[model samples]
Target: MQALTWWRNPGTKDLDAIVCDGSVRAGKTVIMSLSYVLWSMTDFDAQQFGLAGKTIGSLRRNVIRPLKIMLHSRGFHVKDHRSDNMLEVSKRGKVNYYFLFGGKDEGSQDLVQGLTAAGFFFDEVALMPESFVKQATARVSVEGGKLWFNCNPAGPYHWFKLEWIDKLKEKRALRIHFTMQDNPSLSPSTIARYERLYSGVFYKRFILGLWVLADGVVYDNWAAETMTTHIDDVSGYESYYVSCDYGTRNPTVFLLWGRKDKVWYCLREFYYSGRESSNNWDDSQYVTAMGKFVGTIKASIIVDPSAASFITALRKAGYQVIAADNDVINGIREVQNAMNNGKIMFADDLKHMFAEFSSYIWDDKAADKGIDKVVKDHDHVMDALRYFVFMVIYKQRTATTAKKPVWLR
Candidate 1:
C-alpha cells in the first residue's frame, strides 16, 4: 500500500522507476505486481502496458498468476492469451491490455524493440540482459508511466547493480530492499530451510541481500548443513563407486559414492595420513583400511592416476581399480556444475571432506594470469571428489544411448 500510495500521486512522487531487490519469495513481486496493475487501471485508460521476465513462462508464473487472483478479488476479470502471450483485464466496462516480452538474452533487445507502453513491470530484472533492459526502459515514453522491477541481488559487479539500481535519486527512482522476514506468512522452519540451502557468495547475496563478488571460493555452490546427510541406509542406491587421492605427507582421502535416480551421493569417506597415524601407515596398511571401508560390497575403486604403487597393490588385493581422469579444470567444472544443480551430496560423517570444501579457494595467481586453477593446499578430498565426478559420473552421463549430454563435448 505504501508503494501504491507513492505511485498514486505523481505530483508528490516523481520517481520514474521503482526497483525492489532482495531475497527470494519475499512478497516483493506480489506487492509490486498488484500495485503496478491496479495503479494502471486509474492512471492510464485504454492503453497497452508491458510485462517482462527472463522468459514469457517466468512472467506468467511470477506476475500473471498472482495478479489475476488479486484482480479477481477486486471485482475484475482477467484473460490470458497464451497463443500470443498477452493479458487482458476487464472491470465494469473498463479494460487494460498487457504484452509479454522475454528478456533472456542479448537478442531480447529486439523482442521489445518497438513497444511504446504506458508502463512496465519487469520481474527478476537482474538476470535480464542489459541491452534488453535499456531498450525496454526507452519504450516507456508515455507521460506518467513508470518502470517497476523486482529481483534478487547478484554479484557486486552485475550490470543491474552497476547501472540504474545504483543511480537512484530523489523523485527519479525508488529503491527498496526486502528479506524473507518481510513475508509474515513464511514459517520459521521454511526460512531456516532456505538459510541452509545457500553458502558463501550465495548466502551473502540471496539470504542477506548483499551484492558480493564471486572471486574466492571455487565450489561456492556447497551448503554443508543442507547438502550433507547421514548415509546409514544404502539399500536405496543401485550401485556404488570409490575414488582415492593418495598422499604420504598430506592426507590420503578416499570418497565412497552411491548413485540413485541419476543423482550421486558421497555416502562415506576414509581418511588416513602417515603423519597423523601413530603407526606411520604405508600403502599396504592404507590398502588394508580401504578393504575394511568397502567390506563385502560390489564397488569400483577409482584411484589417482599418479598412484601407480597403490593401484598395483589394490589390484593385487583382488579389487577392481581403474586410473581416474585427472583433467583439473574440467573436473572442477564437473563438480561445480553438479553442486550447482544439487546433484552432489555428502554424508554427514565426512568431516574432513566438508572442511576441505569450506576452505577451498581458487588459485589467485592463476586467476590473475587468466588461468583457472585451484590452490593445491588441503585439497586431498576435493581432488577425490573431482576424480569421481569427472571419470565416473561424467562418463555415465556420456554413455547414455539417447541424445548426448550437453556437458559432454
Candidate 2:
C-alpha cells in the first residue's frame, strides 16, 4: 500500500516509477493494476495509455480481464475496441484510452514504438526483453506520468534488477518486494503447493523473492538432516525403479528408487568413479556389479540413451532396460521439483550422490555463449537421479495431478 501511495500521491517526493517484485499469487498485481487504472483516470482525463505483458494472451489473463471486471463492479462504463484490441473507460463524465501490446520476444519492441502514453504498466517485467522495456519506457514521455511494474524475481544480474530497480534513486522510483504472506486470500495449503512447484533458481526467485545469482550448487534445497535418511526396510514399497548413467572414464552410477504412498525414496547407489583408475572398466564389470547389487529384485531399469553397449549388456544379463530421457534442462527441473516438494528422500549411504549434487552448477560460459546448460563435471549420479525423476516419477505424478503435464523428450 505504501508503494502504491508513492505513485498515487508523489507529492514532494516526485516519483515516476513503481516496481513490485515478489512471489507468485501475491496481491501485488491486482492491487497495483487497480491503483494504476484509478489513479490514471483521476489524474489525467482523455489521456492515451498502454499496458503490456509477455504476450497478448498473458496480458488479458493477468491484467485486462480482471481489470474490466473491477471497473464494471464499480459502475464504470467500459467500451471495447475489438479492431484495435483496446479499451475506452469512462466514469463520472471522465474518460481514458488504454492500448494493449505484447513483448513476447526482443522483436516485440517494434509493436510498442511511436505511441505517446501518459503512463504504462508492465506485467512480469523480468520475463520481458530489455529492448522491449526500453522502447515501452520511451513511449511513456507524457509529463508527470509514471511507470508501473510487477514481476517475480530473477537472477541478480538480470537487467531489470541490475539497471532499474537496484539503481533506483530516492523519489525517482518506489521498489517493493512481496511474498505469499502478503496475500491474505491464499490459504496455507495453497502457499505450500506453490512452494513445492519450484526449486534451485526458481525457488530463490519465485518462492523467496530474492535476486540471487544462479551460479553454484544446482540442488540448493538439499540438506543432510532434512532430505537424507536411513531406511533398512523396503518391504513397504509397492514397486521399485533403477536408473543408471554409463561412463567408462568419467563415472558410472546406478541409483535404486522405491515408491510407497506417493513418496519416492533413494534406497541405494552403485557408483564407480574412474578418475583415479589406470584402466577404464568395461561394460561387463558394471553389469556384473549391477546384477550382484539387485540380487533377483524385479525393478524396471532406465539407462543412459547414449550407452547402447551398456543397454545391450543389461538386457543380456536378464534385466529390462528402457532408455532414459536425457533432456538436460527438463530432467534437472524434474529432479529439483521432486526435492522441492519433499517427494524424494535420499538414503544416508549415498554419499557420492550427495557430493555430486553439491558441486553441480550452471555453466556461465555456456550461458554467455547462448546455450543453457549445466557443468558436466562430476555429475554421473546427478544424471541418474534426473533420469529417474523425469522419465518415471514426474511423468506419473503430472499425469494424475497437473491439468496439463509438462512433457519432455
Candidate 3:
C-alpha cells in the first residue's frame, strides 16, 4: 500500500518542488517530504524549507511528525530543532534547509520574513488568513523552489482557492482532489468512523472528494426568468395536453404544454398538495382540483401510466384522458435530443420544472461514482416532464389528430 502511495505520484520534472494534494488521511505530508528528499537533492543551490499551519499545535502534530518520519526513512539527516522549535535537514555534505514554523500564529510572516527558501509548504491551507499566506509566498526568493499549498477544500474562498483555483484562471499550481479511499492503509473501522461523523455536504466534500455546494441546492443552472418564455393570453395555445406525476403525500405536479404556430411552448405548471392536515389538499381533492385546472385551461390530458387511478378520475369528469407511456430511460433520451437540437423551451413561471431540468443528471451508473440521482426526491418535477415528453414527442406511433403531439414539446 505504501508502495502504491509512493508510485501514485512520481515526481514531475517541473516540480523543482511539488505540493501533495489530498484529504486528511491521504498521506499528503508523507508524500510531500518523500518527494522532497528524493527529488530536491539533485537541484543545486541553497535549499530553504518552510512548514506551517493555522496553529502551532497543528504544526507540531499533523505536518511535522509525519514529515520527520518520512525524512528519516528516506535517509535525510536532521539537526536537533531548537527550543524555539526550528530545525534543518542535510545530506552528507551540501544541504541547506530550515524546519517547521507556525502558520497558526496570526503574526507568522515575521518568522518567515526575509528567508530564501528552496521550497515552502502550507498545510491545511484553508485555515490560514489570506494575508498571511500571501506574505509567505512572497518570501520564497529562491530562484526555483516551488511554493507548496495543500488542503482539503473548506470554504471555497480560501486564498489557495482564490489564487490557484478560482482566480489564477490558469493552472499555475498542480491541484488534486483526494479522498480517504485513496489512502488505502486506513482500517475499515476508521473509514466508517469518519463516514458516520460526517454527512451531507461536509462528508462528500472531505471524504468522498466531491466539489459540492453547501445548502443542498441540487440545481445551480436553473434560471426561471431566462430559460423560460412567458405568455399571458391563452388564445393561441391551441389544443393542450397535461402530463402529471400524481402523489398524495408529495406535491402533485402537472406540466401544461401545447403546440402553437408550429412551436412548442411549455408555459405553465400545476403544483400543490395536502399537508399533514391543513395546508396540503388530499388525494381525491387534488385529483378533482386537477380536473378543474384541466377545465379552466380546457386541455386534453395524458398522465403517467403508473397513476391509473388519477386517469380514471380525470376521464370520469368528461375529459379526454389517456395513459402516458413511461419510458423513463427513453424519455430522458428524447429530452436530451430536444435540448441538443435547440427545440426545448420553457416559461418563466415554471420554476420547479426548471429546477428539475437543471438537476436531471445522466445515470452514469457504470462509473460507480454516484454522479446521478439515487435518492429520487429531486426528480419529481423531472418525472412530470418525462411524461410530458413521452406524450408530446417520442410517441413512436402517429396520432390521427392533426398536430400529433410535436415531439419537441
Which of the numbered candidates is closest to the native, going by highest lDDT?
Answer: 2
Estimated TM-score for each candidate:
0.63, 0.64, 0.47
- Considering lDDT, which of the candidate structures 1 and 3 is the better prediction for this target? 1
RMSD of 3: 20.5
Give the total clashing residue pairs for model 3. Answer: 10
Over the full model, what C-alpha lDDT does candidate 2 score relative to the true structure?
A: 0.83
Indicate the worst ten consecutive residues by lDDT in candidate 1. 400-409
Q: Candidate 3, which ten residues in sequence have the lowest lDDT sum?
A: 366-375
Clashing pairs in 1: none
lDDT of 2 by residue, 73-114 (tens): 888887878579688999999999999989888899999888
Question: How much RMSD separates candidate 2 from the native structure?
Answer: 7.0
Q: Model 3 reaches what TM-score against the true structure? A: 0.47
Which one wins on TM-score? 2
- If both were scored by TM-score, which would come out higher, candidate 2 or candidate 3? 2
lDDT of each: 0.81, 0.83, 0.61
- In angstroms, how far off is 335's CA in candidate 1? 9.4
